[model samples]
Target: MFPERLKFPRRPRVRRRLGLGFVLGLWFGFLFYRPVAGLRPLREMGRAWGDERLFVRKDDDGVSSLSEWNVTGTYKGAWGFLDTTNNSSRFPDFKKSNGNSVIELVSTPTKIKGVHYVQGVIIFHDVFDNERTVGGAQIRVEGVYIWPFRQLRMVASSGKGGEFSQEDDYILSNPYHLLGVFSSQVFQESPRDKIWRRKNSPVLYDVEKHCNIEFAAQISRVSSNQNDGERDNYHLEGLMESPSVEEDGDCFSPLLLNATSLNIEVYYNKAVNYTLMVTFVSFLQVLLLIRQMEHSNTQSGAAKVSIIMIGQQAIMDAYLCLLHLTAGILVESLFNAFATASFFKFVVFSIFEMRYLLAIWKASRPMNNGEGWETMRRELSVLYSRFYGILLGGILLMYEFHNYIRPILLLLYSFWIPQIITNVVRDSRKPLHPHYILGITVTRLAVPLYVFGCPSNFMRIEPDKNWCICLGIFIGLQASILLLQHYLGSRWFIPRQILPEKYSYYRRLDQNSNHATDCVICMTAIDLTQRPSDCMVTPCDHFFHSGCLQRWMDIKMECPTCRRPLPPA
Candidate 1:
């Protein structure tokens, strides 16, 4: 908030020119030079060019096996198991490659740590103590979430292409088996191991819709071949994803590219477009205000201008409406955009300013105050200097740096909406002059709603932008008008009378003559009236003392003699 004593900055004549020149240069560079150069390399790197498949492992050798897969897609893989025993034992194999997963979450409870990338082979045991270890399987995998309580229970189905039934499936001897299996097969092909790893080897299976496959090593265990520990459970370790990992010839990088590009296209683009629309609407609004003030109109002329002004306002209102409706999309992406947040501020502040003007007008009415006027002055000063200051300033800052405070703004809106509704209900009760109410009702309420309801309104933009400038202009106008009104009210005389005849008896008195007279209102003799000049006459052809007349006017604008009210002229 600016201090009460703030003076508008007086920029040097050349400052504006320099600012415009700089902006033009920057935009020109962005549009012509940098944009093309930045995208040129991307063009040559054909969209279809990508790495083949990925691996899931956890050591130096296994890590290398998964590196090529990381070049094309991004994932986080984890291996955890649920054993079908009296107590149902579970183990989490923490081997990893591409440590960061596609789904990122920071949560409570260890089991729900979500997916992570890995490459490895494992064995599975049947109820008869027959162990099967699958080998030479190229693995590209991530975390396997087991609903702790539903570890053995079939949680859900992928609905892709699979089925399970109790009829013929009752012959299934391996009822104590794992589902929701993770493997590198989805991203890779042609395992170097031939005897076990084949496309139609029945490795991949669907149980209740989940795509899963038994590791090649698991089958070996069923054959009872005691394999080496390292060979028995293979694993690999790799990179943890971070911003520094710029796009490269990798699977993960390409997926990242798609996500990043989509976000920019949806959010930033809408912001810029909304900002432009706001500028245009603000320009039109300012123009309309100027025209309304300067143009005197007959019914026909007013109709014509009203049509044009209403059209422009309608367009702006429509865009504002759309911005409100799509707030989830725009705000979720980037909170602080001028279009998404500050534009609403513009609408709100504009309404407040209009009300402020009306309040000032009411305060300035001749019948409303005397010493009571100072109370109003204090009220207005406090209202504008603090509450309005904080509101408008916060809005301006929000518009400029919306992304940083988007979350805070969303929270604020929850509170602000109710407060606004309450205030609207309270302030709608003034006995407004007919003309004023008609004008305000038409301009403020009717037009905004109509505009928003219109689909093709001219002010339509992804986010509303015109709000900040519009709000500033409104505040400025209100303050200026209030100051001017104060000046005029103090200077202008409505209807007043000055009585000279009431002091006629003391006209002859002078320092040399040493004469005196009686007070006209009280008719009290006093030697102090060397020349009674405090008398005032009314237009009613009656005379009264200055003090008497001031008191009389305070109570009633009527003559003491005939009791006729003083003419407003």
Candidate 2:
């Protein structure tokens, strides 16, 4: 009942339009305009930092030109911190530089009469930028072929990317030649140049007269991707240093050495050793399997063998884990070790190891009671879940202190340890299962061996090689046993059922042929006309695909028809 004029509601169109306009302005200011503004300084910085030299001239248009620079003698090791060091102190008078954009080599050594040589592009980075971050040009090596021939051909290199240049022959007899060319027109020019923030934009280095060494490598093997002659495999930076101006060589420039390249050959060796170790362990696992199967059937000769193998396997597993954990510590490039060595991490790992040991000990007791094992499992599970929740929560909340990543890793290890223990313990409960026994035994042994080799630095204690070797042998024995049991299944004591060869492949029966309509055992529908390889019919008349039945039968021996055990062949 207020005055009609006062009761009328105001419209929001003007306010909505104003709000939209503000949002649009913000988007342009922050997202679009700001980035463009930053790029302006970035380009200027690139051009100002390096030389704009002309190396080649075909005509007045300057259609073909190359920039040249060199670094002779050892400049301040830190002066050209971002350039590759292959050309640094390693090569005297190393001159390496590249045009701002992509360049093409029109002729190779074969095209002109001369000695064969390698030619590759080199991009330069600013010294200040190099000191601040990891910066270097990407050198993509095209495949090297014989030079000093009539005509020459080049193609893009290949590996993950596809190969190029399938044509093989060279041109008629002539001189070996190599010509380099760059475009006169710039891909990026002023007026149309985009600007961006220095920090946000990629920092490019355009060096002047000084030689910039970006990377240095001490290689026992040269050109891992190529199998060319030894000359192509020179120690390092030979090409960057030797070229002259008449031959289109940039002057020697400073080379910067950053981090050292990893020894790839060492890694390859490690992989081989690791694989051999795995095979040996697998063999032992198989042996344990056979012993378990033998014991289940006769229970006469397998007890001692089983016990010994289990012990050996445990020792081996623990030792291997320790080796890896210790290696992780030794490699200090990453801060993970310091984090893992924290008090929290130590405590968590200790708790996890203790829980696993307890489970094993409880299971191995003379008393056949399983209550202790179950109790320990429950306790470990609760602690594991609780700690994990806390760790995850802390990390998610960004409350993960600098000190906590390591603790989390240890706690994570705990989760897996229990799982490993559970798998062995649960499976071993079957008594005659060799695979389960071997796994359990190995896990138990691994713990002590790991502890013995503790503090991997060998400062405290070192595992005897003889003992380790013995453990390896024992693991191999267990692996062999498992392989045998895998063939035997649960009824290793009972002779296995073997169907007629005719039933191996699935086949459809002819409508007129006298054939059983259902599986002999289960009475299930079976298409007789289908090949035996494709379908299988049990003795009770249940029909199924051979693959499906084979897989199912591996786990179950009884026929679907009568729940009767499969007949011994």
Candidate 3:
């Protein structure tokens, strides 16, 4: 018999909830609250992109225009201007200019098959007011294209002295080429002036089309006090490079092609949708897992440990949902790109994956040395889980040093799910319920599909259609399995049955028996005279209430007092 002092401790109540609440509160507070000025909540800071406007002015003409110039660049294959700084150094000669303002322009022309083809321009501007007292300065120019296309033709001077025509013939011919025009900026000493702009006309598509593009930066600066007739003189100098013509068939560099052709909107939309889907699915799974855990009996050590693991996973999933929601909001808000959020999300996911693997390792211990196929299956799980778990964790750690590790990590993560699910199914002694099977299968398939389909890294090609088709097949298979299981009226989830012969073997105590004899399962006295059928005596001579014994047996086929194994149903 088990010693009375060796009684199992009752599970703590509200502990998991308290931990979950604490974690969630910390996360919300970090993302939504700030103690420092200028450090607004993520949600509010994100609005700067939409509300901030750029004012550009041409110094000579004093013509000013308003433009929304968002940061644009490629991040993990997605295009947008988020978390990117636009700052360039001043030219050597222009550094001595009045306000330490310098603008350098370079133009390159490409010739293909003895024909002049494309022209590209790169402009670098740097301005600084050393005198702190100088209120502000402005730079403005006319006839500058805001969103210049790949193909551009400079208009000839309209017989005016040192002045080119404000209108270009190519602008009218290619109406779509004009995305916007450059406005003026009234710079303050507090925020120094810096601008880096690159524009290239599209070269011909044929690789045989040897094309070159040339560009130049034209800028003028006027101080805020210039209108007061103060003795302030601005100097303008132009430096032009001799055009180099190439006969080679290199139409354009691959990097240049990608930068010009990329459609930011498409990738941005895909990211938002993908994050939303992950959040929804993760939330649903958390709810379902919690329900399953609550219904589970935790009398056995393994069951108790599994319950704790599930609770941890559910909490992690809830956090993941929050992260995804926050990331989606920031990306959509145009305040920040997905880079920062994606990194944090990846870290959290890596930690969660490690914990999950640990749980699986613990759960598989009992079957590791068992006889027959169970032993082989358990060994397989242990080997793969250990190998991949170590590899994945190492890769995540190494990713900080090298970005190329991301693709490999994603590939491994995709396959890890299926391997885990296979082990789970193999480890189960009884057939899994259809709902359980469906959930596992869908999650395994969906994660890989989402990982591979989403823009997680830089790639020259889009997602393959074949992979998408395979993903759809997996989804269909899950639905079919659910339908088939339901049609067959599977008894997978039914409670264990107690044979009449087994119950009849338990003898009921009489009224003369000691009133202090209590059932081990419920700690209640076995009052046989009050209700004879409700009391039972175990084969070990220990007594218990019938209902208590039945409930105990439902969790494990063992005697509550002696802990002896009972006959299997």
What overall lDDT goes with each candidate model? 0.31, 0.34, 0.36
Worst 10 residues of 1 by lDDT: 175-184
Instruction: Summarize candidate 1's per-residue lDDT along 1-569 as a digit string, tens digits.
Output: 47533444545546888999999999988667654564344233322122111112222322332122111111123322221122111111211111111211111223212212222212211211121222112222222211111110011123322343332122121111110111111211223423333333323221112223221110001111432222222122222111112223111111110110011233246445655554454444444444443332222122112222232233334434445444424234444444444455355335533433333344334354564768878866864565446545655775444334424333332321222232222211111222332233233422233233333332221122343234334434433332332344311222335311222212332333343445455775445343355545456445456677655544444566677655321
Q: How accurate is candidate 2 locally (lDDT)?
A: 0.34
Candidate 3 lDDT (Cα, 0 to 1)? 0.36
lDDT (10s digit) by residue, model 2, range 1-569: 56765545434666788999999999877765554464444334333434211111122322222211111001001123235454433223223422222212222333322322233322223322222211223232232222211111122222312332322111111001010100101111122222221232332211221323222111122344552332222122212221232444443443322211223233334333433444344455445544544444321122112332333233334434444444444333312432332322233234433333333443344234545778767765875565446545644543223223333323322322332233233322133454554464564354335433333321112245565455545545544444444454323433335422223223343344445456544446566565556665455555565655554454444565576544321
Position 225, candidate 2: lDDT: 54
Clashes of each: 56, 112, 36
lDDT of 3 by residue, 1-569 (tens): 36644444322346767888999999977654432222233214223322112112233544342321211221111111111232112111222222122221112222211112212212212223232211122221121222111111222122322322323233212111111110011111121222111111111111112323222222233354552333322223222211213543222221110112223455445555654555455555545444433443233222323322333333344344344444434334422434343444444345444444444454445435456788667766876665557545654565342323334433432432332343233322222234544664475455445544644422112244576666656455544544443454322333437312323535544446546577777776666566567776666667777788766765665787788765422
TM-score-based ranking: 3, 1, 2
Q: Decide which is better by lDDT, 2 or 3.
A: 3
Could you tell me every candidate's TM-score relative to the true structure? 0.24, 0.23, 0.34
After superposition, the stretches of candidate 1 with alpha carbons farther than 4 Å from their true spots are: 1-263, 293-364, 369-373, 379-569
Give candidate 3 regions above 4 Å deviation. Answer: 1-273, 295-427, 430-433, 443-461, 471-554, 557-562, 565-569
Q: Could you say which candidate leads in TM-score?
A: 3
